[model samples]
Target: MVLPISRFWYKFSLFLACLLVFWAGFYPEWVEKYYAQAFYPHWSRTLRFLLGNIPFSLGDLVYGLALLLLFWAIGRMGRDWGRMGFRSASWLWLGKILHALLWVYLLFSLCWGLLYVRPSLGTRWQLKPVAYQKEDIRRLTLSLLDSTRKYRQRLGTEAVWRPCRDSLVPWTLSAYAPLALAQRTPALDQASLKPSLFGAVGDWVGYTGYFNPFTGEGQYRADLPFVLQPFVALHETAHQLGYAPEDEASWVAYTAALNHPSDRVRYSAHLELLGYALAEEFLLYGQEGSFAAFDSIAKENKARMDPGVRADRKRIRDFFLSRQNQVSPAMNALYDQYLKLNRQEKGLRSYHAVLSWALAHQN
Candidate 1:
């Protein structure tokens, strides 16, 4: 049912899509002006308006149905291979599979994937890129470390907040208020943000939050520590705002959370960015001597953290480590490939590029 095209038409459509993708690569400004700024806002707004009040994640439901359909197709093709012979079945199903993929890619691109080709967030904002050194990263790490401790101190020991959707939604929206006002972009006055239906599975699979581009909804794991939820939610919402790349979403979210009025939200943002800053700083230390020596240096660096910060970080680390399984690495590898295919040159490493943008902004 998905393929309403003849074989010739399917090939033609695929050819057109390839051409469009090639054109998009060369004309990022055009995509930014027409698609990201003009078309995507109206399209995403309509989707949010239609889907926002739903009590559950319609996006998750869509994914579930899609998986079922995939399984059904595989089963049907297997049956066809027995009945119609290998060559005949291959001829039949391969074309169908290609057609299905074409439809999926087209829908994905029209809905959200084309945002991948839009101008970089820095270019969009006209921020001058700074040539940062190891010292800049070290200073940023120290600054973030100090702020994280201060904010964590403010929250005291009672950091566990209930995932009250009512307040959480507004908290994230309000974080974007100043940016929305300044940019005069689409108003995220309403949201289709939800706790992901796949929360438990997501913990093992490793994602705190994601935006469902197909359904125009932002989803976060409700079971995440309160400290992690605010920034995760804001990051997902950044996707809904049409910042497609991981680093772009993170940079936008970090900047927004920094402007947030709540100490908890600001603390959450700084704490996570501190980790990124530290990781970048660690790379500066490089591989000095043996693994044992590097491990010693790592431990020494961590030993400098505030006691409460160390404990909290350990709790967060242990939470994920306990849930991790054999599947996590394979899933992560797949996602890394997915990012690379989407034009993120650093793949998973793109998430850490927020530190570079932050450093640029600082300079």
Candidate 2:
């Protein structure tokens, strides 16, 4: 008796999946560093440039194509399996189980390896304080402007300035390339990270954002006030650029916004760091000056904040402080592990680390 072509194909796919799982688990670093470097960095930007400006609805296009393929596959399977009966059914069930097992094994291997090696990989940079005074803000702003101008000169017209839905595609694609190659998959479904109402309801300041590991999409809720939106947009955009670690994302976004040409964008970046500076001051010095600085900035920011924006921020802050948002011991441990893996010596809590860099340099 001859084996069916479908059975042979399914078995081959299963074998390939198993091989991928083994490779991914044992050699994640090689895969991440080498394979990722080859296509991800350059292809990402090219693909984004090509697809970013397409005007058609991606949802409609994707769903329509998926439905068509699903129906076509079902029809073909039904016709073919009608002749094989129990044998076809058995093969189908077996193939599905093998596929699922392969997926589970791959996921387990990747996560386990990442968790295991995180501590060994370290960061190259450190944060130490420099004097920061109100008088220095103008100088700092000018330095950022110079950096932005230089970067623009280097990149020419292709430089990223404004935030758009497609602006983040390159970053997201690059971040996920390793996983995609490891699993021998085309790409994960990034559409899941698209902004939704559900995400906006939870601890989100009218602008919930996420760096989705599965699809590698950095999604953001775009309805927030302009003051906060630019910074958050840059933060999420950084994640899309393969900066998975939160503090790094914060730093990159801060720099990006600070360098942006617009005054509002610059202010947004400053505010984010200023908030972190205040937090650090409170934790380290515990002086009236620390609180005084925070209060002054808060009052100034508040005077500028739109009423609707203030209400939204208050609602989001309350949600963040609620029981549901409380940090779990396990999560904290994992965070520590992640910091160690990423070479972040200061651990996982310093979104303000960029301030030290900002303070030390003058344009």
Cα lDDT listed for each candidate: 0.83, 0.49
Model number with the top TM-score:
1
Error (Å) of candidate 2 at residue 182 is: 32
Q: What global local distance difference test value does model 2 have? A: 0.49
Which window of 10 residues has the lowest lDDT sum in candidate 2?
113-122
Candidate 2, residue 156: Cα displacement in angstroms equals 31
What TM-score, to 2 decimals, does candidate 1 have? 0.92
Clashing pairs in 2: 118-341, 122-343, 123-343, 171-240, 172-240
Best by lDDT: 1
TM-score of each: 0.92, 0.47
RMSD of each: 2.9, 11.6
The runs of at least 3 residues in candidate 2 whose Cα sits more than 4 Å from the true structure, single-residue gaps closed, are: 1-33, 46-197, 204-207, 287-350, 356-363
